[model samples]
Target: MNNNNNSICNKSVHKKNVQHPLLINFGENQDGDGFDEFILDTFRFVGGRRYHNVSSSKYFLPNDLPEMDRLEKQHYLFLHIWRNNFSAPVREKIITKRKSSLHMAFEYPSAIFIGVDISPIFPSEQKKPDNATFLQNMLDGLPFEDDTFDFVYQRSLASAISEDQWKNDVIYELHRVTKPDGWIELMEPEFLFSKETDAPNCHKFSRALLGFLATLGINGFISSQLENILTSTKLFKNIHCEERSTPIGQWGGRLGEMMCNDYIESAEACKPALSQFIGISHEKFDSMLENIRMEINQNRLYYKTRRFYAQKA
Candidate 1:
């Protein structure tokens, strides 16, 4: 990364204080070096996981439902709750050099207005808009070259990556694809049982969910440690972190209701796995979730989501 170039870009953009428009292109680069073919191969080999684990399902709440529209609405609500319009400044520097095209990649493409995903659970019968393209591919082994994109963004992937993969493969891969002085943002939620605060049943549910995920070699609390994890790489600079509490029920207003719905749907989706690994019966699990919902409505328990971003140097 050129320090002088970055400093110039920063000064120019900060002076304007305008959000930069992102330019995203999903297809192969001008090089045409089998990047598209590699994406196809990855999708074929890395089929989506079968068991709907809670830890993973949080990334895509209501994972079992095939309704694309509802899922998209849920995602938009989530973004609104987190104040997506607050715009990270690092992205402005990346956008200043490009055209006004924006492309986003998602695991489930149906719900999003544009861009593509590895696969769509509910394939849309309607024609896709010109701005949207759907591609099937996995995150761990992206097909793009080093510095292919100006900005890279991923959210709620803690369940998809294990602790080892996070430290070794995932972070490095993200760094490799980002342009020098460009930005990458990761958003994730920490799942921990509330202790000594009067939410015992909710805590028990949280404990069981975390314990079950541990059997699969995933760390449920990884979100809380992301700052340390990314800083250790020493491959990035100007790292920024932000956290917000997501209220679960009506007490938290519209955002709370949406978050509560996400949590409920996430728990419901993981019912089968919870029953199998933790010996939690369907009836018992449903009852417990109801109690948790009540607790959320009463403002007794909440979960926190962390957003981290940095400039690759």
Candidate 2:
């Protein structure tokens, strides 16, 4: 929030001409390509825009940036640590059976990738590949029909929904849209960390952030309760959960460096809300974030991530 702080709040509205592997844009149809046309049509039919009216501020994170790149990096980081998109065995089934036509149309041999976000961060004019498609949508009420997808997964979306919505709407809708015996997974961070030695400023900022989120009806520790939430739904079976801890700075290697940057970005993204709710100044908030970064670079800090998955029965 500091004047010198990288304008993290500045929204990127212009579409960049640059192309990345993760950018998926399905442009108008060209002649003599029936299959590609069919796929694009299907993607359009299935992807809905029920939440288009919702403001991006409701998401509790900065969505005005090129999040596609951040998501691509985050996806690879998970793959690097877990070696797969999921820990549940149903992931293999979803990959092998090809039961979901929506999943197959985007990718011939590989699993189809479809992303929906409330922000217009993805490309909208370029010709997208068959492997993936991105849409603007909301999590609370997905536009898909009941039992439509083979695997339903939500990651780092804890801040997007309130506690009541998570309990009454988000979980139910995710379960409702998943096919019988399909899988639903949630991966989120607790946003709580520790350092080898006492770092008062960093701890103070972290606590303040957690408290701020709580006022919005978001549980900063929701990741730890994911297993219980899934089990209590009575709509899933074979529930499983896993946790991984990684260093934040040079001590954690290249991956750690990336994670450190991720943490910093998250903090910066939440600055506006923190400032408004906690009455903290932009300069003080920026200083606290810098101190946290310093702790990470000093190899004194580490954080944990939790992943939970279950099968819809």
lDDT values of the candidates?
0.53, 0.57
Task: Mark the 10 consecutive residues where model 2 has the least summed lDDT.
Answer: 1-10
The true-versus-predicted C-alpha distance at residue 236 of model 2, in Å, is: 1.0
State the RMSD for candidate 2.
Answer: 12.3
Candidate 2 Cα errors over 4 Å, as ranges? 1-57, 66-68, 96-112, 195-197
Residue 180's lDDT within candidate 2 is 87
Count of backbone clashes for each model?
1, 2
Per-candidate Cα RMSD to the true structure, in Å, reads: 10.3, 12.3
Candidate 2, residues 12-88, lDDT tens digits: the string is: 22221111111111111111122343343322221121112344234555433233345556656766766665555
lDDT of 1 by residue, 1-313 (tens): 1110211121211111111111132211111123444444332221232322222222332322332334455556656766552234643443322211122322213222222233333233243333343333343254445665556666656765678777877777767756888777777787862331466667777888888778767788899888899999999998889987665679677877877777776676667667566686788888988987776676545667788888898
User: Candidate 2, TM-score vs. the true structure?
Assistant: 0.74
